[model samples]
Structures are given as C-alpha cells and as structure tokens.
Target: MTRKRVLCISYQFPPFAGTGVFRVLNFVEHLPDRGWDPVVLSVLPGHYERGTALDDGLCARVNGSARVHRTKCFQGIDAMLSLRGTFRGNATPASAGQGETAGTAPAGKGFWQGVKDAVTLAYRIPDKQVGWLPYALAEGVRICRHEKPELIYASGGPWTSFLIGLALKAHFHLPLVIDFRDPWMNNPYDELNVGFRRRVNRFLERWCLRRADAVIANTEPLRTLLADTAGSGNKCHTITNGYNETEYVGLKARASGTVPLVVTHVGNLYGKRTPDSFLQALTRLIDTGRLGVHEVAVRFIGHVDEARINNLIGSHPVSAMVTCVGVVPKNQALKMLFQSDIALLIQPDTRLQIPAKLFEYIRSQKPILAVCGEGATQELIEAHGLGVVADADDPEGMEGAILDVFRQARSAEGHVKKDYMAFEAGALTTQLAGVFDGVFQSSPQMKNG
Candidate 1:
C-alpha cells in the first residue's frame, strides 16, 4: 500500500527533551505502522531556547524511521538572553543534571523585570518560537514541492507550527491537521499573555482553527473547548497524549519501597506549577511527626524554573528532603519513575491540560499523589483508582495524602494495576491515522490537489 505522506510540523522534537516532545514523537514513530508516512519539520538544536534538555537516546530512536528536516532559527531572543547572562556573570542556559539545589536564587520581581516582561509580551506576538516561522516556512515549502506530501500535521505550544501549516495549506492547497497540546488563549497562565496580546492570540487561534481540516486536542476537555472555538465540533477530536508501551517492554517496578520513601516527579516544574503547597505539606508532615525529616525523599527529575522553584525550595525547611535531579536522559528518568515508591504530580489551575508524564506514571503502576484541583488530571486519577488526589490549596489534605502514600509504600502495596491499553501510543496513533483517512477522503483540497 502506498502510504499517504504527512508533513509533521512541531517546534518540539527529539534531542530537545520535555513533555512537549512526547506527543509528536510518539505519533511520528507509530504513524508508519498505521500506513501513514510522517515527514517531520522541526527547528535545529541550536534554535532551542534556554533550559531545554537534550536526550540523544530519543533522537537515535527516530533515526531512519522517518525523514526529519531541521532548519536553523533566528535566535534574536537567545542571543539577547545569552548576552544578558554573560553580563550578569551567570552561566548561559544553566547546565542540566547539576544534582539537587542546581538553581540560582530567584532575582527580585522588580520594576525592570516587569518592564522586560511587558516588552516581551508586546513583541513576541504568537510566541518566542515565532523566530522559527520564516525558516520553517521556507523549508516546508521546499518539502511540499519536492516530497509532495498529501497532508500537513502541525502540533503546537509553539503555535508557530500552525501558522507554518496554514501558510503551506494556502500555498499548496493540501489538507491541514492542527493539534493543540495546550490551550493558546484560555491558558491558565495569563501572566504570559494579557491585554492586547491575549486578544491577538484569541484571534489567531480562531483564524487557524477555521483553516485546518481537522483539529486534535490531547485532552477531551480541550477538544470540547477547541470545538466550540472552531465552530466545527465534528472536526475536532480527542486523541490524547499516551504512553509508548514499547518503552516499558522490559522495565519493571521495584519489588519494595526504598529506605527513605522516594516521591518522584519526572517532569519540569514551572509557572504556577510549583512545589510550594507540596513542600508546605511535607513540612507539616515532619512538624507533626507523621513523616520524619529523613524518612521521605522528594525528587524532581527534570527542569526547575530557577527563580520560582529554587527560591521557594531554598527557604523552605523541607529543602533537605527535596532533590532536584535537573534533566536526565529519557531512559534514566523512566528508570527513576519505576523505582520510586510514589510518583508526585503538582498540577494546579490548569483544567483542560494533562501533562505527558501522567500516562508514563500510569504505565509504571506506581501510586500517583496528584496535587491538582478539579480537572481532567484529577478525574482520570480518581476514575482509575490510580492513587490519591488533594487540591493544591488544601495543605492538610495534601499532608494526609502523602502520609497515606507513605504508609501504602511501607506496606508494600504502592503499585497499582489498571487497564491502560486505550492510553498506548500505537493505539492512539491508529486513531490519528483514522482521522487522517477521514480527512483525506473528505478533503476537497486534497481532491483538487
């Protein structure tokens, strides 16, 4: 069978390790099995912003499976930030895997910082990754002309990929599929975009949604939200972020809990997703003599937003109990996740979004202690009986949840078994391929082309 070609436009790709990379990475790997050839278009490694972690293992996994074209980006912001860091006598993009306490103390939220943020918000129209548009657009056009791809699949957080896809669709008259891993305008982190910038984002979101032939959201709630905006509810689908079961082929959960109960969070903590409440709960547990100071160990295995996370952890009494492992390779991180007694998730204020790490946690079968309010994350955890959930604001509840997990681990019953075949990457990719089939068959653009 002749596989239909899809030009996958994603700003986040392998080597640049983060939650953002996993969705598209999985799709790229599995799309071929479903009779779709994925041709990925991404930014070069140098174009990646500061604090991005590289995973060579992941990069190698993609090699030869599909053709990947990486283009250079205009690094205006990177240059400016690097220059600023040089002047400030700090390292350029703080080195990863510096062990626990690997961050500098957060600078004061002064007038200058406020001004800088305002200026950045005003200029970085779609996002900071807007710098990649021109280069990606050129490369996309070249690919369309040479490779003659039948469809365009654009995944976003760096929503620039959508714009690139839109431009290509306009030029080539091909079917376009846009995937939203996170909300653009309705994003809970309003601090990043507000006033005029926020309004501009809403307009762009509607503009792209109207143009795309199919829209995919990683969460069902997000699918509903996008469906309302797109005004074509039927076209919007929920093909969620799922685990790569093949990655867990030989991995096994620990037979028993560690000496000091390890509560591991495998992803980055930034924005409003801080460990403030979790740390507070830990402190309370120690104060009340529920959990000893050295009895429970909390590990953050990925990136930690220097200012927000470190400053908070630095002053906290539970700092000694917490370890930030910075960013490790994908395999190492998964090993850490499986070996831990409990997996900690600090998801607050985001209702529609579910972090990619959640699926992996499900695969690990380790008890998840999610400090999330009422949303998709909470609902999934509760529905599956995965573990415990405590709202971030409820310190007492979080403390209790942690204590409960500790006890369960101590009793050697922390591992959970749940039916998650629906959350597997290959299954999810089959759904994506089904979407592709419908779009290709129904698309007037493809017919005309």
Candidate 2:
C-alpha cells in the first residue's frame, strides 16, 4: 500500500519535555502502522522556554522512518539581551540589577515586568510563539515544494502553527487538518486583550476553521465547542490524548508491602490548579487522626511553584509529609507513578478541559484520586471505574476519597484496573488515521489535490 505523506507542523517536539510533545510524538510514531508517512517540522531546541528537563529518550521514540525537519526561530527578548551583553562586554541591565537572575525577571521589577508583559501581550497576536510563524512557514513551504505531501497536520497553541497550516493550504491546495491540543479563542485561561486583539483572534480562528479540511479536538466537548464556534460540525472530530504502553515495558509496579501510603502527582500546575486544596485535605485528615502524618506521603514530581506550595504546606500539620521532587526525567517520573499507592490528579474549575496526565495515571494501574469539578475528568474516572473523584472545592469530600483509597491500599485492593486498550496510543492513532481517511475520501479538494 502507498502510504499518504503528511506534513506535521508541531512547535513542541521531543527533547523538549511537555504535555504537548507526546500527542504529536505518539501520532507520528503510530501513523506509519496505519498507512501514513509523517514528515515532522518542528522548532529547533532552545528557541522556546523550557518548562521541564529535555528527555532524549522521547526523541529516540520517534519512528525511525519519519523524516524530522528542525528549524530556528527569531530569538526572544531575553536572548537578545544576552547577545547584547556578549557584544558590549558588560552585564545586561536585567542581569546587573540586584537580585535579578540571568534568565528570570528581576525581584523588584513588578511594575516594569507588568509593563513589559502588557507590551508583549499587545504585540504578539494569538501567542508569544507567533514570532516563529514566519520561519516555520518558510521552511514548511520549502518542504512542500520538494516533498509534495498530501496533507498538513498542524498541532497548536502557539496557535501560530495552525496559521502555517492555513498558509500551506492556500499555497499548495493540500488537505489541512488543524489539531487543537487545547481550545483556541474559547480557552478559559487566555487573557485576550479586549477590543482589537480579541477581535483579531476571533477572526483568525474563524478563518482557519473555515479553510481547514478537518479539525481534531482532544475531547468531544472541545470538538463540539469548535464546531459550534465555526458553525460547521461536518469536519470536527474527537481524538483524546492517550498513553503509550510500550514506554512502561520492563518497569515493575510498586511492591504491595511498601509502607507509608505514597500519593504522587506528576505534572505541572498553573492557573486554578494548585496544591492548596489537596494540602488542606491532608491537614484535615491529619488533624482528625484519620491519616497519620508519618504514615502518608504526598509527592509532587514536576514543574511546580515551590514557594506557593511551601506556603500552602506551612499552614498544614502534614507539612513534613509533602515532598516536591521537582521535575525529573520522564522515566524517573513514571517510576514514581509506578511505586505510588495512589496517583493524584488535580483538575481546575474548567469543565471543558481534561489533563493528559490522567491517562498516564491509568497506565500506572494505581487508583486515582482526582480533585476535579464536574467534567470530562470526573466522567472518565467514573466511566472506567478508575478511582474516586472529589470536587476540587470540597475539602471534606476530598478527605473522604483519600481515606477510602488509603483503606483500599491497606487491603491491597487499591490498584484499580480498567480496559485501557482504547486509551492506548496505537489504538488512538488508528482512530486518527480513520479520521484522516474519512476527510480525504469525502473532501472534493482533497480528492483533487
């Protein structure tokens, strides 16, 4: 069978550790098995901010046959400052300021930082990563001219990648599929500048959706939201994030006799998703003698605000029991998940979003204690009988769920198993392939392109 070639425009790719990278990586890895050839076009390393340590292991996981093209983007303000210092033979103003670190904002520049942030926000349309759009588009066009790919798959935000897909669709008349890792204009967290900026985003989103051959959302709700926003439900499809079981090969689950129930969370926390509520629950459990301070350990293993977490823990009696391991390698984090008695999943108030970490926790086979509002996360937990879900705002409910899991751990029945075959990466990739097939077969432009 002749495999259809797909040009994948992803801003975040392997060696750069992020939740965004895995979806593209898994898709590219499994696409070949489903009769598709992926040509990845990604930004070169060091162009973007690093949230976690790079994992070369993930880079190695990309299919050997896929041709990956890495390109450089225009440098950011901080990088330009460093370059100016190098040429001038003096410390940059940002670096020379008292308590100002090399890469971070100054300690006393709250006002200046706010001004700079506002300026950047006002200038950068869609996202700060928009600076990479021109370079990515140039390289993408160059590749299309030579490779003549049948389809363009652009994963976003840095929603700029979708713009690149839009441009490619115009230039080559290829079938452009925009993958929304998260909602664009409808994203609850984004602080879009009112008036002109917000209007531009809305226009850009509508324009892209109108031109897209198909749109892929990670959840059904997101698909519906995008379809409704675009006023076109014909091209929208849901393909949820999933786990690659092959990564867990040769890793043993936590031994049954391990003492001190270990509850582990393994991802970044931002916005409304914080450890305060969970910390409060732990405090209640310890105060009530339901859980011993020494008998329960809560471990955090990713990019987290240390000061904020410490402040939250300071008010709690179980302060010593909470440990933030910071960010570790992907395998090391997985090992922590494997050895955990219960995997902790914290969801914010957003009902439209689902964290990719839940699927990984499911892969751990450890019971999950999801602190979430009523949404996809809670629905998946209940549907799969994965574990207990407590409202994020309900401390008493959270405490009760934790206690139930603790009791189950004591009885060696805490590990809840579910049929995860459908959530596996390979299976999800096959479903995505089916969508690609459907779009290609149904679209007049795709058939003619």
Candidate 3:
C-alpha cells in the first residue's frame, strides 16, 4: 500500500528532547506503519533557545524515520535573551506555558527586569514561538508545493505551528489537523493569561479551531474544553500522549527488592509544579522515623530552577536523600525509570493536562506516587489502580501516601500490573491515522482520493 504523505508542522522535534517532543517524534516514527508518511517541518537546531536539551538518539530516530526539513528562525528577543543568560528553554518567561510555565510576578524585580518583562508581555503574540512562524511557514509552503502531502498535522504548545498549518491550508487548500498538547485559552497553569495578551490568545485559538479540519487534545478533559470552539464535537478527538514501546525493548526493570527504594520524577519542575510540599511530607516521614533517610532515595531527573529548588531542598530534612539528577538524554531518563521502585508525578491545580511522563511511568511498570489535586491526572491514577495519589498541597496526605508506597516497596509489591496497551505510541498513532483518514474523507479537496 502506498502511504499518503502528511506534512507535520511541529515546533518541538528531536534533537530537542523533552516531554512534549516525544509526542511528535513518536507519531512521526510510528505513522508509517499506519500508512502515513510524515514530512516534518521544524526550526534549525542552531535556532533552539538556550537550555533546550538535545538528544542525538531521538534526532537519529527522526532522521531515519521521516524526511525532516529545517529552517532558520527569526530569533529576535529570543536570541538576545539567550546571549544575556536571563532566559532559558525555548520560551521567554512571558510566553508562560510549555516547559516555562507561568507564575505570579516575583516581588522586588529590578527596574531593568521589569522593563524587560513589560516588553516581552507586549510583544509575545500567540506565544514566544511566533518568531518561528515566518520561517516555518515559508518552508511549509515549499514542502507542500513539492511533496503535495495529503494532509497537514500541526502540534502545539508553541501554538505558532497551528498558525503555520492554517496558512499552508489557506495556500494549498489541503486538509489540516491540529494537535493541542496543552490547553491554550483556558490553560490552568498559565496565570499570566490576562488583559490584551489573553484576548489575543482567545481569538487565535478560536480562529485556528474553526479552520482546522480535525482537532486533537492530549487529554479527555481538554477535548471537552476545546469541543465548543471546534464547532463540531465529532471533529475534536482525544488522543492522549503515550510511551514508545521500543524505548523499553532492551531495558530491564530493577529486581523487586532493591535497597534505598528510589522514587524518581522525570520532567521539568516549574511554576506551581514544585517539590516544596513533597519535601515537607518526606521531612515528616523522616522526623517520625517512618522512612529512614538511607532507606529510600528521591531522584529528580530533569530541568529545574536550580537555586529555588536547592533552597527548598536545603531547608528540608529529607534533602539528604534527594538527588537532583538534572536533565539527561531520553534513554538515560528511561533507564532511571527502570532502576526505580516508585515513579513520582507532581502536578497541582492543573485540570486538563496529563503529562507525557505519566504514560512513561505506566510503561515502566513502576507503582506511581502521584502528588496532585483533583483532575485528570488523579482520575487516571485512581481508575487504573496504578498507584497512590496525595493532594498536591496537603503535606499530611502526602506523608501518608509516601508511607503507603514505602510499605509496598519493602514487601516487593511496587510494580503496577494494569492494562497500558491503550497508551502505547503505535496504538495512539493508529488513532491519529484514523483522524487523518476521517479528515481526508471529509475534506472537500480529498473526497475522491
């Protein structure tokens, strides 16, 4: 069977390794089996902002799996900030979402810092990723012209990709599909969504949804939130972020009775997603002699605000057991997952987002210790009997939950045995291909194809 070509406009692709990148990378890697050939359009690696971690392995996988086109980005303030060493990651502080989550304005900022903040807030239209639009759009036009792809898929958080897809659809009259990894207008974590910027985001989100041939939200709650804007309920679908099965092919789980029971978190910790409460809870566990410092260890294996997180951990008694491993490559991170007894998930107040790490933790067969509030993350953990859930802010609840996991770990009962087949990347890609098929059939341009 001849696979139909699909132009995938993703702002975050490999070698840019992170939680979000895998969704696009995995889709690209698996779509071929579903009879869809993906042609990825992304920014040049040189254009990736400072602190955006790269994984050569993921890059190699994409290179082997698909035909990827890279273009130069208009790094204006982004380049300036990178040079200034003030900003980190692919987003400016003002474009507060993705890895750089939004937070309340810090007290006592210097005059120059305030000025920079004001300028960034005023300039960030749609997002900080807007700088990539002109470059991606031009390259997208070239790819669409030459490849004549059957459909277009644009993934967002850097919602700029959707604008590029919207433009390409306008130019070529092609079927366009948009994937929302996180909520835009109603993003719970985005406290900076206010005034003119929020209004602009609202307008852009609606405009894109109305134009998109099909819409994908990573969580079920997000699909419901986007359904109204999507115009038709059927057009918007839920295809949750999933784990790639191949990542676990050669990896072996740690023997059930490993000493110093490891509880690892494998993503960025920013904004409301902090470890203060968890550390406090762990401190209580240690003070009461429930969990010995040397008996259990906590490993944080991704990007974090080093100074802030260090301060939080330093003031705590559990700091002795806590190890901030920092950001490692995708393979190493997964290896740590296999080496651990319990996997930790920390999310508070976020209602719609179920981080990609959740699926990876499930795939590792580790008992999950979810420190979160009432939301999709909590719901999934409870529904699957995957592990224990403690309220994000309640230290007492967290203490009890940690003790529960510790008891289970001591008895060699720390592995999960729930059905995780639905969260596999290939199966999810099949669902995505189904979406592509629906769009192709319904599209006025492809009705006869």
Candidate 4:
C-alpha cells in the first residue's frame, strides 16, 4: 500500500519536555503504522525560550522513518539581550527549561523596568514566539517544494505554526489542517489584555479557521467553541490527548496502605489553576483536627511558581505536610504518579480546556482528587468513577474531597475504577489517522494532485 505523506509543522516537539510536545510526538510515532508518513518541521533547539527542558528520551521516541527538520529562528529580544551581554563579557549562558529569562524583564529597576515591561508585553502581540514564523515558513515552503506532501498539519500555541501552514497552503495549494492544543482567542490565560490586541487575535483566529481545510481540537468543548466561532461545524473535530500505554507497561502499581496518603500533582500551576483553595482546605482540616497532618502528604512535582505556592502554604498550618519537588524526568514523574495514593487534577474555570495531564493520571490507576471547575475534567471524573471532584473555588468542597480520598486511602480502596482503554495513545492515534484519511479523501486539491 502506498503511504500518504503529512507535513506536520509544530513549534513544540522533542526534546522539549512538557505536555504540549506529547500530542504531536505520538502522532509522528504512530502515523506511519496508519499509512501516513509524517515529515516534521520544528524550531531549532537553541532558538527555544529559556528554561525549556530537553527531554532526550522523547526525542528518541520519534520513528526512524519520520523525517524531522529543525530550522533556525531569528534572535528574539532575549537572544539579543544575551548576545549583547556576552559581547560585554557579563552574561551567563541561558538556562534550558521553560519560563521567562532575566533578559525578558525590564531594562532597568523600578519605573524604567515597568516601562520596558509594558513595551515588551505590547510587542508580543500574538505571542512571544512570533519571532519564529519567518524561519518556520522558510523551512516549510522548502519542504513542500521538495516533498510535495498531500496535506499540511500544524499544531500550536506558538500559534505561529498555523500561520506557516496557512502560508504553505496558499503557496502550494495543499490542504491544511490546524490543530488547537488550546483555544486561541478564548484562551483563559491569554496575557494580551489590551482590547484592540484581543480583537486582532479573534480576527486572526477566524481568518485561519476559514482558510484551513480542517480543524482538530484536543477537547470536545474546544471543538464546539471553534466550530461556533468559525461557523463551520463540519470543519472541526475533537481528538483528545492520550497516554502511551507502552510507558506504563511493566510498571507496578503502588501497594496500598504501605505509606502515608501521598496526593501528587505533576504539573505547573498558573492563573486559575493555583492550589490556593486546596491549600486553604488543607489548612482548615489541619487546624480543626479533622485530618492529621502526619496522615496525609501533598507532593507537587513540576515547575510551579514557588513564591505563590509558598504564600498559600504559609498562610495555613499544613506547611509541613507539603513537599514541592520542582521538576523531574518524565519517567521518574510517571513512577511518582504510579506510587501516589491519589493524583491531583486541577482545572481552571474555563469549560473549553482540560489539562493534558488527566489521561496520564487515569493511566496510573491512582484515584484522582480533582479540584476543578465545571468542565470536561470534572465530567470525566464523575463519569468514570475516577475518584472525587470538587470546585477549585470551593474550599469546603475541596476539603471534603481531599478528606474522602484520604479516608479511602486508609481503607485501601482508593484505586482508579475504570480502565481508560479509549485514552491509550495507540488507539487515539488511529482516530487521528481516520481524521487525516477523511480530510485527504474529501479534499479536491489532494484528489487532483
């Protein structure tokens, strides 16, 4: 059988460690098995923003037949600042992990810093990664001319990837598929607060949606929102994030009641996803002597803002019960989750977004104590009997949920109930392949070409 070719443009790919990289990586790894050869176009590693960890293990997972082309990005403000500092003999090499660097801060202390910060924020109209577009587009066009792939697939929040796909479609007349790992204009954590900028983003989103041959949303709620906005429900489809079952193979589940009830949260907290309510609830339970501090322990194992977490914990008397493990390797993190008595799934109030971490949590077979809003995460937990769910904003509910999970742990009945076979990456990859097949067969351009 002749294999179809898919040109995938994604700014987030391995060896970058984060939830963002897994979707495309899995697609690349499994597409060939489904009769599609994936050609990936990604930004060069050095061009990535500082503090993004390089996961070599993920890089090794790419299929040998899949061709990955990494191109250089024009130096952004941080890179420029670092260059100038180097020329002046005063700069250290930038860290290789995710977060803002010192160069991204204000040019000076106090007022000057505020002014510089404002300018920088404004300059990042769509996103800070906009600087990568020119390089990505150049590489994309070059690849299209050489390989002439049947379709172009772009995944984002460098949302620049979609722009590249759009440009490639316009230039080559190839069908384009844009995947939304998160909503563009409706993003709850969008830092672009200016009314005009927000309007610009909305316009851009609509423009892209109209031109793309198909849209892939990682969640059903997101697909509905995108379809509603684009006024083309037929063009949108939902293909959620899933865990690679191979990762969990041979990993033993933690024996119950062997340790303190370890409730583990395995990602960063920001915006509405903070642990303020959870901390407050823990504090109240401790203060009221409803739950012993020594009976339960909370572990955070990723890149969370320490100051914010510290402030929340310090306000409560449950400080001794919490451990912030910073970040660890993906394998180690998975092991931590497997050993955990309960997994923490914190969701923002937005109904359109679900953290990609939930599938991994489910795969661990560890019960989830979800402090979330009314959204897919909550629905999934309730539907699957995956454990307890509570509103992130409700201290009483959160406290009750936590206490319940702790009680279940004490009784050795805290394991996750449902088998999430549908969420296995291999199966989900087949669904993605079906989407690609449908899009390819229906596209007049592909048929003609």
Count of backbone clashes, every candidate in sequence: 0, 0, 0, 4
List, residue by residue over 1-449, the lDDT tens digit for candidate 2: 76788999998898777788899899999999898999999988867664445767777887495899988776465554455446546656655576755799656457655655665665558776777888898899899999988788999877889999999888887888999998777677876645677788888998988889899989877888899877899889889999998879887887875888898999988888887888888888888888787798889898788899777767566878888898787788998889888899988776777889889988888888888888777888888888888876777788888888777776656754668878899999998898888777766665565
* lDDT, model 2: 0.82
**2 versus 3: better lDDT goes to:** 3
lDDT of 1 by residue, 1-449 (tens): 76889999998999887778988998899888888998999988877877777777788879766899999987656666566556656533453223325365444326447756665775467887888989999999999999999899999988888999999999998999999999888788746787788788889999999989999998888889899999999999998888988788777776684587888998877777888888877877777877777787888987786566567766656778777789787788999888888888989988998988899888888888998988889888888888889888887788888888777677746654677788998899999999999999888765666
Taking all chains together, each candidate's TM-score versus the true structure is: 0.84, 0.87, 0.87, 0.87
Q: What's the CA RMSD for each of the models?
A: 7.4, 4.8, 7.2, 6.0
For model 3, the run of ten residues with the poorest summed lDDT: 93-102
The segments of candidate 3 whose C-alpha lies over 4 angstroms from its true place after superposition are: 79-118, 188-191, 304-319, 411-413
Candidate 3: Cα lDDT at 261: 86
lDDT of each: 0.84, 0.82, 0.84, 0.81
Q: Where does model 1 exceed 4 Å of error?
A: 79-119, 257-260, 286-295, 303-326, 407-413, 445-449
**Which of the two candidates, 1 or 4, achieves a greater TM-score against the reference?**
4
Q: What tens-digit string does per-residue lDDT give for candidate 4 at 1-449?
A: 67899999988998887689998888899889999999999978887888877877778898595899998876466755665456545533343223555567433336545655665565565667778888888888889989989999999887778888898999888888999998888777776645776777777788899999899998887898899887899989989888888888777777877766788999887766788888888888888999887878889998787888787777565888888998887788999888888898888677777788899988887888888778777777788788888886677878898888777666656653567888988888898888888888888875676
**For residue 318, what is the lDDT in candidate 1?**
78
**Clash pairs (backbone) in predicted model 3:** none
RMSD of candidate 3 to the truth, in angstroms, is 7.2
Clashes of 3: 0
